[model samples]
Target: MPGLLALVGGDEFKPGNEEQDRLMVAAAGAGPAYVVPTAAARQGPDQAVAHATEWFAGLGLALRELPVLRRSDAMKASLADEAGRGGFFYLSGGDPGLVAQVLRDSPVWRAMFGAWRAGAVLAGSSAGSMALCSHTLVRATWPNRFRRRAMEALGAVPHTAVLPHYDTFGHKWVESAREAAPDLTLLGIDERSAAVWHDGRWRAAGPGAITVAKGAKMTRFESGAEVKGLRQPARMLPGR
Candidate 1:
């Protein structure tokens, strides 16, 4: 069976996001939800874990922390083993480029794929969400302007790119993202909102909306709305 995947905008472990959190737990059934704070490691993994723990506790689900912070940690057999047993695996928000670099071709990442294929819910927020796409948009700041560049990602979803926090700074990056990769479909997800992949398509969940942009046409989808034409193509990253 194909596993469930959720790409969230941001503000994951806060209030007002209870509904989507519950839905994710429900998708996983009866098992602990693994929290991967690799992206937030630079800021502080402990804080991120604490927040996720409290948030999941409100939903009556256990949150397990997988502290795969560095590239070496990603190669640890112990971490990989723990990651393989989760019912729901959540990737917290932080630096998207760093997340992609640490997990790319790592043992822990391979374990995550195996676990998800065997029936686990895989969820990512902000940078986490961006790292899962075939192409990732890395934002840079100069003396007077901000720049958006495209980079290689895990390719869990092929020919696709995600812009998290769309209700805020994400919207501004949409056009730049399109210009960077015109052939790829761009998804702008609002903060506290999610776009979940299930039943062969993506569906909007949570309070905010999801915007799908292709070429010059852009469409918006609200909660419970199904987003069509996001199927995985033949150009998916190897071993995806």
Candidate 2:
């Protein structure tokens, strides 16, 4: 079976999605799903753990924090185990840049790629979703008068960049993505919306839509669209 990928622009571990959660569980051969929250800048270790704890409780599922993610070695080891188990891996929303930095070239990130290739489900929202891209547009530089640097991203989906939080405050700067990676596909996920791919089709699930921008062509998909395995590369930049 094809692995499940829940790519949300941002905002997860909030409420609802019981049916979707059940569907994801079923997709993973009815095995227990792993609720891994990588996005969470405000909360500390304890708060982050507790937040996911409650979110999974509602679905009658257990949540485990890959604390190793905080450490390079431990994170890699944990991700290796996560891949071996063939269980679901859910990346919760927070800071996309931090998530990539924590997992870049680490064992956990390697395991994540392995799991995806092995047909294991990989789900994430907000920052988590952003990290899924080949080039993640992280909000490292706040772009204020005092801060004048662009955020660095961990490229997971090479040649493709992400435009996360398109419906949130981040929408204003999303256009700048073209300048970053002119030749790449832009996936703009909306809040409370999910971009799920399974069985060779991309299905939109939630109250919002997923916008794709390539050059000047911007299209929106509703709850149903067969976009699986489709290679939508980004538009090439000038002089590239």
Candidate 3:
């Protein structure tokens, strides 16, 4: 079986979201859980690690931090070994563009994909989720003044882009994302919610809902709802 993939919206490591965390843990089987705080490194890894530690401790699981902060760290053989060993690997929230820029084509990223292909559960929250898609929405920096741009991502789930925090600020980017990549499926994931891939399709998990936007149509799938054929229309396009 392929490893379970969890793309969380945000607000992970909280009480109400324990069920989702537990699900990932259960999917991990016997290997240890590893938390990749690379995205949160700019904000401070210490705080991110601390948060993950507390959350995992609550579930009686030891949290191993993968310190792949910079591009240099992402290329280390030791970090790749640790990443490959994880039964469940999680990438926390932060700047999605930063995450992609640092980890793209890195040894650690290759190891992570290898581990996931080998049946290790993989989860990404907020920006982490964005980075996992084929095209990621980059929030504008101070100089850019709030512009959103679609950029290349990991392509773990190709032709898809995730808009985290959809219930709040994420909704604003929906139109821009559509205009940027009309053929791509844009998922608006609410906070504390997740879209998990299993049984050959993507299914909603957690408290909030998921919105699937393709061209001019937008469909909302509640928790536990099945999101099927999301890529069909795109595949039918002239140049897919």
Most TM-score-accurate candidate: 1
lDDT winner between candidates 1 and 3: 1
Which candidate comes out best when scored by lDDT? Answer: 1
Residues 77-167, candidate 2, lDDT per residue (tens digit)? 5456755565677777776667767766666666655566566677777777777666667543554411112343434344555565667
What lDDT does candidate 1 reach at residue 91? 93
Q: Candidate 1 vs candidate 2: which has greater TM-score?
A: 1
Q: lDDT values of the candidates?
A: 0.83, 0.60, 0.81
Q: What TM-score, to 2 decimals, does candidate 2 have?
A: 0.79
The 10-residue segment of model 1 with minimum total lDDT is: 231-240
lDDT of 2 at 93: 72
CA deviation > 4 Å runs, candidate 1: 29-31, 140-146, 233-240
lDDT of 3 by residue, 10-86 (tens): 98888767757777777784577888898898998788888988998889888888898899999999989888777
lDDT of 1 by residue, 12-86 (tens): 999877667777888883455789998998988899999998898889888879888999999999888887877
How far in Å is the alpha carbon of 107 misplaced in model 2? 1.9
* Local error of candidate 2 at residue 56 (angstroms): 3.0
Q: Candidate 1 lDDT (Cα, whole model)? A: 0.83
